[model samples]
Target: MRILYGVQATGNGHITRARVLLPALRAAGVEVDMLFSGRQPDRLFNMEPFGDYRTCRGFTFVTDAGRVRRLGTLKQSRPLQFFRDYRCLDLNGYDLVLSDFEPVTAWAARRQQVPSLGIAHQYAFYHRIPGTGSAPLLKWSLQLFAPVDEAVGVHWHHFNAPVLPPLVAPSPYPLTEEEGKILIYLPFESMDEIRYLLRAFPEYRFRIYCNIPAPETQGHLEFEPFSREGFQQDLCSCAGVIANAGFGLCSEAIQAGKKLLVKPLQSQIEQRSNAVVLEQMGLGRVMPSLETEAVEDWLALGSGTPSPWPDVATALATWISTGRQVPIQVLTRELWRAESGNMLSLC
Candidate 1:
């Protein structure tokens, strides 16, 4: 069967998930094409897995100094281009269109009267799960942004719902974490501010990944451009992670057993909610902004236990190949056990 997979390219999490699913789908003997939206195609890197992919000027949230600005987002979004692209996209000859919280393919599948399945963490919001952004408007935006007929939500826990555990890819290198090194990936914050923030903590080393022209290392801090190999290497070796409260990186930190300190982007319900849930679950520490106090507090704490990442990609691929006729709970439990690898059950 042929499938068109839609991935939201506004952030790295969606792309990271696609990396896991693309190979799994191929191994399951499913033919698939990919479409990325929200970010420009040139900004995407280390995208070797999706073969040839398509892109569009889909909507993206605009941020200023670590906060999402709703007004700016609307102003920046080229609605005319988005509409034209959506209307022109052809979805013929595809057995299914899978949306990973991506808008173009989701809308196209609906307009063209084709089967669409939304397999994403955002879909978990359809259920009464924890960590939902509070504002009703944000809630509505989540629903309308990526509309789909069928939903397959993924989360860190089942929450006694049909949600599956987070899709995490293991570190490609051996896990030899450096106790004094930390990985910083706060894309929304300014690099100069980050450098200033870490200056006080001269004892620890900081490796930051952001929109740098090239690699540059200074006293106590190293700044590098976005490279998948380099970023993963730093993450695997780092003793801790300092980043925004994004799902993908948090999942990676947990899987890799790295100490985590997160600052949720203001005005983003998802990030704020993620922070609350992280504190509630005792998974990580959260600060509203990148302040020195939070960093000091986090440094005083120990590296807590990280979650076990399940091999949901392959199992989900199998389920898709089998027509998704059975309830996903059966597959959810199957994959949850496999994630545990006979060590622990998700609480």
Candidate 2:
């Protein structure tokens, strides 16, 4: 069957999920085409996997310092262009459209009456997941942002919901802990602030991955431009991870068995909720903002046990390929059961 896959490029998490699933889907003998939106074409990198993917000017949030700037986000949105893209997106030969919180493909699927499925962490909030109530309008906008015929939410825990486990690939690098080494990936925060905060802990080495133009080291801290291969190598060896509470990175950290300290983007409900769930599961530590005290407290603690989640990408792809005749509850139960008693349910 032919499928059109839509990915939101505003954040790396959506793309990360797609990265894990695309291979699995192809292995399942499904033909697929990828479309990405919500960020400038020049900004995307390490994207050889998608293979000549199409792009559109999609909606995105604007952030300053560490918080979402509502006015700026509004100013950045191109509703007319979005509508045109939506109307212009041709879905003639696609049997199904799979969306990772991408509005254009979802809307096009809706307008053309093509079957659509949303598969992303954001869909988890559709259920009674944690960290969802802070911004009511933001919460309400989820459905309007990307509506689909069916949605499969992905998260660390099922929370007694139909959500599946995080779709992360096994570490390509052999997992090994390097003492006194930590990986930092807070892209939303100011680089200068990160340098200042991390400089206080000269005892530990920080490998920061950001939008830097070049690689440089400042005393104990090493700054590198974003590279998936380099980042994965660091992730495999680092004793711990310090990053924004984006679902993808945190999931990778948990899979790699690294201790996690996350600073959620202020007013972003998804990250806040993700932090809450991480705390609830005793999987990681959360800080409201960038602060020395929070980092100090986290560093003093021992590493949490890795969840070592099962290969969910393969499982989901198999299910989707065979036909989604099986109930979501059945799929959820089996995947969680495969976790070897790692599942933590709130319901």
Best by TM-score: 2
lDDT of 2 by residue, 118-192 (tens): 999998888888777666666468889999999899898887789898899888898888889999999999988
Please, what are the lDDT tens digits per residue for candidate 1 over residues 246-300?
8998988888878899999988777877788788877889988789999998988
Question: Model 1 residue 168 lDDT?
Answer: 78
Please report how far candidate 2 places residue 22 from its true position, in Å: 0.4
How close to the true structure is residue 242 of candidate 2, measured as C-alpha lDDT? 95
lDDT of each: 0.85, 0.90
- Winning model by lDDT: 2
Task: Give the lowest summed-lDDT range of ten residues in model 1.
Answer: 338-347
**What is candidate 1's TM-score against the reference?**
0.95
